[model samples]
Target: MSEQGFKYSILASGSSGNCFYLESPEKKILVDAGLSGKKITSLLAEIDRKPEDLDAIFVTHEHKDHIHGVGVLARKYHLDIYANQETWQAMEGHLGKLDLDQKHIFQMGKTKTFGDLDIESFGVSHDAVAPQFYRFMKDNKSFVILTDTGYVSDRMAGIVENADAYLIESNHDIEILRSGAYPWSLKQRILSDLGHLSNEDGAETMIRTLGNRTKKIYLGHLSKENNIKELAHMTMVNQLAQADLAVGHDFKVYDTSPDQATPLTNI
Candidate 1:
């Protein structure tokens, strides 16, 4: 890693909760804070970070699993919260009372700089009022955090191309999801263009966006009941191989867990 590189960790990611910690030379922020405030604080502690050290929280959507802890963390730490106007309105009722100064809204598709890092939000296909994903750039390096989307449009794929690192969704395996214990309606929701991405779709998105600059790829947002880490990992590896890409030599794949944090990695 270079002196000006970016670093990040998946504090937790899944259907249960989804949060990520990212930092540039002059900034430290959470992409989302989906767990309980206490739990998120504990996870940050494991990485030797303190809540008081954070700059802000950037939300992907208003879903409970994606914004559960946003209000608590903001009130406790006096941190700023960034989201599109639509997402802010949808999540406001559930986030409790927040100080006006703590709320910051960013326009979709526009880049905003917190410090050394420049982040751009783009729309994603999800059930929320206005779901979004982000691309963070610093010192010519890019890191993308894209999850909770049913399908990646070609435009979105182009926006994230050549990222140095990625934490993208690989929610479930098609066969397992089809035969899993979930109700048929629920399965359809997960398979819809407005729902979550299946493992196969996630792999294809990776193959489309991957480039020479890509170094690490973290498969995230797995379903505990319908998918397992090994299955998601193997699915990605096999699909990438079919695209003439090697997992290790070309880029390493990592699995994110709902209960733990991935090692802080440089991008």
Candidate 2:
């Protein structure tokens, strides 16, 4: 289906919660189920999909913001939940006793196939016990989603470079984070190697990894209180332009709003 159309939807993205739907006629997967069960169901309805339409739900980490609704969604929909072994362990408390029939655990650095989609998991620098990111492929089209990573590593870049569409985190502007109302301890955590990616760092990664095949870039996991969508867009646009890529005219750069369903679009 290389010549066939494939679609991906943000559904929702932000600090409050994050979830995405990726589909081809042969596969339908949800990257995460962070929002409430009702909210997730509503968002799926907006896209004309039902919870049962999902083939699997892949979790990036055990952060509450990313897995808040996982257990409920899984219990209600009985969807297969995929995660690295370590992540599954760390989240055992929240997940309680997962139904083996619906729990599909894999090790990091391994590739798993679901229908027409092939997914590869890679370790990312984040504070979670076993944080990871995902690279998804179907019909020769590839997309990488790496939110919550503190920084981009050489190995991580190798995985991201192959993606035609990259959805990476641009969590905050350093200036705002430094001067924001967050306390000293919290501030240090955000700036740490195991914290979150800064806006400038995210742009630098884009400048280095983006090639002609890259058509869309989504800045995800933004801080509602510390960062502005315009600022995040401008930061990436300016950096990419220096590399000779225009913003909207050359490619799409979308801000995943803090609490709204972004319409699904073809990559």
Candidate 3:
């Protein structure tokens, strides 16, 4: 409750690319830099910052959309990049070359520090090797970022339930994804246990996971093909509404954009 300074911005989100900008009192960092270095830095400039100002980049998993710009940004800015041991193995070759000193491997479930902030990674079910989600905390307040998982496990829900704010995946609507023009294999992949969250699944997860203290949420990683912003938004809103957890009164939900940066948020 005493957390003073924490900010998060989704520089971009979706299947095409993903990136996040984060700041703590004594450290400036990014969660992922899936965008090109040029695009990432340009987005940074929009917030009146620069790549050289970052202290580190924390990667979630090995997917290209989560790491496309990691190597370039790290090499250009001479910044440290943190990833779990398995993730490092899965993504190292794909990231091109990185200086030895720039690699910082963290143990999953153990806490690591950056100035006033503390970060913890937890396993999440996904197609990639060692895919995961993260919790970032300072003082008693916390923010959580979870994406690219097919379903929300009880354990995963428990881990993130009490966060002050959350950036969670609301990837597609079930009917839309199933009935869309995508091929059968692609549709099955998206609907599988290792695929992505459907809009209804997202709503159910939030109903189970969101605490009374949790106030703000940004629905992210939406699919441009099988989903649209308003559908995802109204889906969750209506679900929560049925649960009597009214939006705006109980909490606020923001739909993240795939093509542009979402508004800066504080936690």
Top model by lDDT, which number?
Answer: 1
Per TM-score, the best of the predicted structures is 1
Clashes of each: 0, 0, 0
Q: How far does residue 172 in candidate 2 sit from its true spot (Å)? A: 0.5
lDDT-better candidate, 1 vs 3: 1
Root-mean-square deviation of candidate 2:
1.6
- The lDDT of each candidate is 0.92, 0.83, 0.86
Candidates 2 and 3 compared by TM-score, better number: 3
Give the TM-score ranking, best first: 1, 3, 2
Query: What is the Cα-based TM-score of model 3?
Result: 0.96
Better of 1 and 3 by TM-score: 1
Tens digits of per-residue lDDT for model 1, 89-129? 99999999999999999878989977888898899998889
Off by over 4 Å in 2: 1-5
What would you estimate as the lDDT of candidate 2? 0.83
TM-score, cand. 2 vs. native: 0.95
Candidate closer to the true structure by lDDT (higher is better), 2 or 3 = 3
Comparing 1 with 2 on lDDT, the higher-scoring candidate is 1
Give the Å shift of residue 5 in candidate 3: 3.5
RMSD of 1: 1.1
Q: Candidate 3: what lDDT?
A: 0.86
